[model samples]
Target: MSEKTGTFVVTHAESESAVVRDVETAQVHTLASNPGLEVHDVLEATVAPEPPLEVTWEVIDVGDRRSIELVDSDLEPTQHEKDLAADAEVGDLQQEERAGTGEIHVFCVPEDEVEAAATDVLEDEETVARAARLEAVRVEVRRAPDAGVLSVRYLPD
Candidate 1:
């Protein structure tokens, strides 16, 4: 005995495209667009059926579930932050080890999302400094987590 799969028909909008027929029942199939209406015309007025809208997306392959990037935003680093960063001291062994392993990623999210963190970090600093440098980017705003923030990675070139 053979199992039979169900036959189906589907129609979307005033689609000039569709498939409607049963393979087992050989019958005449008709593709009739509204009387005398052209493809574009069927999709235009308040009378004809709606058309399927098309949307496009750009694909990206970021290395990891990684840090946020500030690409085209109006954000900029602050002068006070510059002074503070300049005054920042070197990290001890634990800090140095984190830098060496590439584990910590920093992000500067929108001002509204920064929680119990020091307001000075985001308010004074425009760019979210990361253990790794940003290579490729999407036009978006992302924030980093609460961790020992590093002003700069003093790792030698």
Candidate 2:
């Protein structure tokens, strides 16, 4: 009996069963029971294959479960981030861990589409999940309009 532990996103859920996909491995697992999961819920869990055919899985343990919030940040990008944006080439992306906690993602987009790109990050679940990763509670989108620069900050609390 082997168990896999990772961050999983609930892709589908029903009264009797549910499906989750591992964020890192992209492997899909069908659970033997619903476990009260809901669509888009992110979970830190351990799963093991069910008995018999072992085609389905069971949640052996759950370390954490959370839903992330995405909002347009009123705050402006930091001066240092602005400098990075100015120096980065178009379509360039820079990812760095926050000094304290969480993560920072910086992107250089087309000047005209910076707003649209930011909105996409706000509305796209997968995009937000990819940015937020593990233990992120909220995601903030800060855009430098006309500078073709955008920043997505993932916060732990």
Candidate 3:
């Protein structure tokens, strides 16, 4: 069997994104915000840190798929930002709870990549990434106003 990727949420399977996980290479399919970028022959996941945005949290329940609360990463919002987000009928988002944010979030980023990165630190001492295959890996992502831990679940291809 070829490598495969399996996307997961709550207790459901997202078959379309599920494919075999290639140990040597991979293609990550993150959300529109975080495009699945490729790393060629990445012997290991190099620490490439990005600056964190000032965010507040809000959890929008997805019901079955999963309740996804979009956390507004912008905590210190400008006057314009606040005005735009405010709704007369709905409560002020900025003033609302952080767990009440985040909406229409795509299941971004492959999980295997995260695992490989965590494991790579130990695995690299023995083996080196000689080649990489452009395989899509099923991944689960969890986000919050406070950066939470995200994990990936690989499936057989």
Candidate 4:
């Protein structure tokens, strides 16, 4: 068997296997699960062209931790928002305003909880009403293992 090396973005993950998208070729590859792997983490893998294309991946780098951006807000996050964010396992909440565009950024979120957390934060009664009035509320969540460097962006619509 021959060896191939490439960078891949994990697209799907389960206990036994995962589907990864090759960064250079844009082709999908499957590999035995690396417990450390998470969706959206870019990694380098050594693959053997066996019958099923066996692969082993190592996380050489990590993506940015910032997740969830709230756009076009005039007011600061209320106590309710803070409480919700904290309960959702978010850390380092920062707000920024530039050219009438308001954005809220957060870090240190768990990959598995990104969608649920974002939904809970954005779907709150007050947040829902505010988002509806704005006509466009964008939230992005990036999750990773807190103990290691594996990172994945799980954005909820």
**What's the lDDT for all of these models?**
0.26, 0.83, 0.23, 0.43
Q: Write the per-residue lDDT of candidate 4 for residues 5-101, one digit (tens) a residue.
A: 6655566778777776655666666665554566545555565443453455433234321112333332333443344345444444443332344
Predict model 1's lDDT versus the native: 0.26
Which ranges of candidate 2 are over 4 A from the true structure?
123-134
lDDT string for model 2 (1-157, tens) is 5789999888789999999888887789999999899877788999999989899999989998887677799777788788878778999988878877888888999989999999988877576457436467778899888788899888887
CA lDDT of 104 in candidate 4?
A: 38
Q: Which is the winner by lDDT between candidate 1 and candidate 4?
A: 4
User: Model 1, stretches more than 4 Å misplaced?
Assistant: 1-57, 67-118, 123-157
Please give the lDDT score for candidate 4: 0.43
Which parts of model 3 have CA positions greater than 4 angstroms off? 1-4, 9-74, 91-157
The digit string of per-residue lDDT tens for model 1 on 1-157 reads 1112222121121444432222233221233332222211111111112223212111111122222232322333333333343444323212222333322223333334433233443332222222122222222222222322222222212
Error of 3 at 42 (Å): 18
Clashing pairs in 2: none
lDDT: the better of candidates 2 and 4 = 2
